[model samples]
Target: MKRTFRLSFYVICLLIGAFVVSWLIFMPNGQERGAWRAETGGVVLELTPLKATMFSETAHSCHTVIAFPAHMKLVEMLEGATVGMNGAQLELAIDGTLNTQRFDRLDALPENCTAPDPASASARDVFDAAWTAMDEHYAFFDLHGVDWAARRALAPAPDARMDDAQLEDMLLAMTAGLDDGHVHFGSDTRGYRSPAERPGWIPEGSNLNRDMLRQIAIANAGATITKSQTAPIFYGLREDGIGYIMLREMDVDVPIGGRSMDAMATAFANVLADLDAAKALIIDIRYNPGGSDTVSFGLAGHFIEAPLPVFTKTTRIGTTQTAPFTAILEPQGDAPDPRPVILMTSKLTGSAAEILTLAMREIPQVTTLGEPTSGGLSDVMGFTLPNGWGLGLSNQTYLTMNGDLFEKIGVPPDVPVPFETAPFLDGKDPVLNAAIAEASKYLQ
Candidate 1:
């Protein structure tokens, strides 16, 4: 029985050898030498060069047989003499090294390739793809969308062989394709500032456009016709013996009662004292981007005698956190008067401003009016790569006081009013007219 098994194994081996030789003889010339393969988090990329290369001829007798693990696009691997693969964090490591970087065939795969991995696409990838698509498919690339050629022209010549710092600048320009809010390079907290403070990190002539200004204006257009400034407190007044407050941002110049709240509680007290019927109040938080929710709740306490859930946050891991809120009418005064109150909002309102809107909904005396808010309400966290490129990812979901989701969608106001055009064009807001009208009716 052993002798018969040995003979059968030899026969099988002989047949496999014959088949391999026959397949190799009929295969196209040099098909085996130019093959490349890679794996990016289980997604495989495979490439085969059609022609013979000097490196392939020297590596093996077949003159064109190279094996690669399939993880990325085949064309991208073939275009390079050296290939680097990034892991889940975009940490780079060499995947394959080649003898030469030249490809000499018309049908050969082109340089600069990408694979279609949905989950692997980072925020930077999304920005890069959006730009490259418009650059290639737009009818007049130079004249339309963000200027791709102009941004790239700022880069040194390809053969210039740039250092890490120079290369970082080129990458920054390349990633600025969408030119949208919350997407920036170098640093995460590079706040929008006056033109005189433009950093040297970015190339020249890259100024904000009308679209960018529109985004900022809409977000800042809270519930009143108050003056616009980057400062936290803009204008405050006592209207009809009622407390009226206009705040652009959450940061305060001084702590409120030494509690370290970002809201100007002292200023709020001073304004409240000036009002006779200060029982009712108006808070214009339409353009407020957001700040410490602690301040939001501290302000909320003035309205509610008892604590109420202002908002809740659910992390990506499913843990829930609830914050309580109330508002104070006056410092060292009685509890917030439950009299009729008006809170203003607009499409430019977002983040903590949205939370404040929802929290007010819990109070029977408060009425919110205006338009839908700017829907940039996702809970995002900043991440910086080893290469110094910054990114923001939406990892957690936010819910309003009433268990309402605020991701991508913003708070909807009780009353919707369209802003008049001419005033808006001249940078004079007309939304305040609508809010004042609504508040006046309730106050009367």
Candidate 2:
């Protein structure tokens, strides 16, 4: 009996040991646990493993391996880089894993690949390579309605006398070759601008500075018709107790609580409060170049009765893997009975503004007027390029509540108002006028 009892105890111990081994074998690794604050270059960033896979085809020497870090998606790592993680330097092999070799033995890539300019390679050559690669790889290239070959053929000549504006125009032409609405060229100082020139928007003798442009934009927003003074940003006539607000850009930072957000919230609230007694609202962002979307939502919430999904964006994991798009919503605010709303847009409005419009587009009481928007409906995270130029491109594609993609094709207007020159010249907006005419029916 003693022998049998001892044997049973040994058997139970063996079983427990096996279970422990199994658990360890199947447990998730540190990489699978999600985002962690990591130190890189004396700066700490929220780091997450994008995707790590093992490739074991050992037929050739120097096993081939690849690794894509989350930061790499935002900023490309230098070639031949020895990635450091968890206090360990990782070596890449052709075999698709990072743990194959010694620290500092592999190469590290500089900001722009650390590759010296090829022998006598001009900026034009670099531009060509980038332009061609973008044309080939950018998603939704065909929908842009641009002639890539023709534009490429018109490459800048040797010793091209390109001013900042001309250089920007050329870059714009090159980018248009990709034809993705979300792709654009932005200034290092200014965040974004109109890709193509707008009529009378540029001020005469206006130096490229904050004060000069701010004054011009403000005057455009509130210019009087009787005055011969040129105002490019805005000009409107109040009608039927409903004041039409047409805007071209919202790029300026509006301080809120001494922060940009505080300013934006105040601006949004003040705009609505100023027009409180109005029977209807026409928020015309037809040529709006887009701005902070959080502000768009705060303003949009004023008209919504319930929360609704506005748009979504996703991050790419690697060449093949992609993360799910994150969704944003329009929250309901304390507006009295939700005022009737109408929005005007063109192939120009985008980003945060697009998200706002999409959320309100389906409501029965709200109607979108004018032509389709720019179709650049994506969530962008801005970063400085290696050349000290700031860029904000689509990091994720946005989808509507009904699972519709609004990337290449813009949001269609319920009432399509074609562009007319005479009304614009006379400072009478056809889109706003139409909205007022339509709202008059509801108000009556």
**Over 4 Å off, model 1:** 1-185, 188-231, 235-243, 254-258, 262-266, 276-279, 318-334, 426-428
Model 2, total clashes: 18
TM-score of 2: 0.56
Largest lDDT belongs to which candidate? 2
Q: Cα deviation of 172 in candidate 1 (Å)?
A: 8.6
For candidate 1, report its TM-score: 0.48
Task: Tell me the tens digit of each residue's lDDT in model 1 across 31-108.
Answer: 323323211110112233322222111000111112343322332333322333222211122211101122222233
Q: 226 in model 1: Cα distance from truth in Å?
A: 11
Q: Provide the RMSD of all predictions against the true structure, rounded to 1 decimal.
A: 22.1, 16.0
Best-matching candidate per TM-score: 2
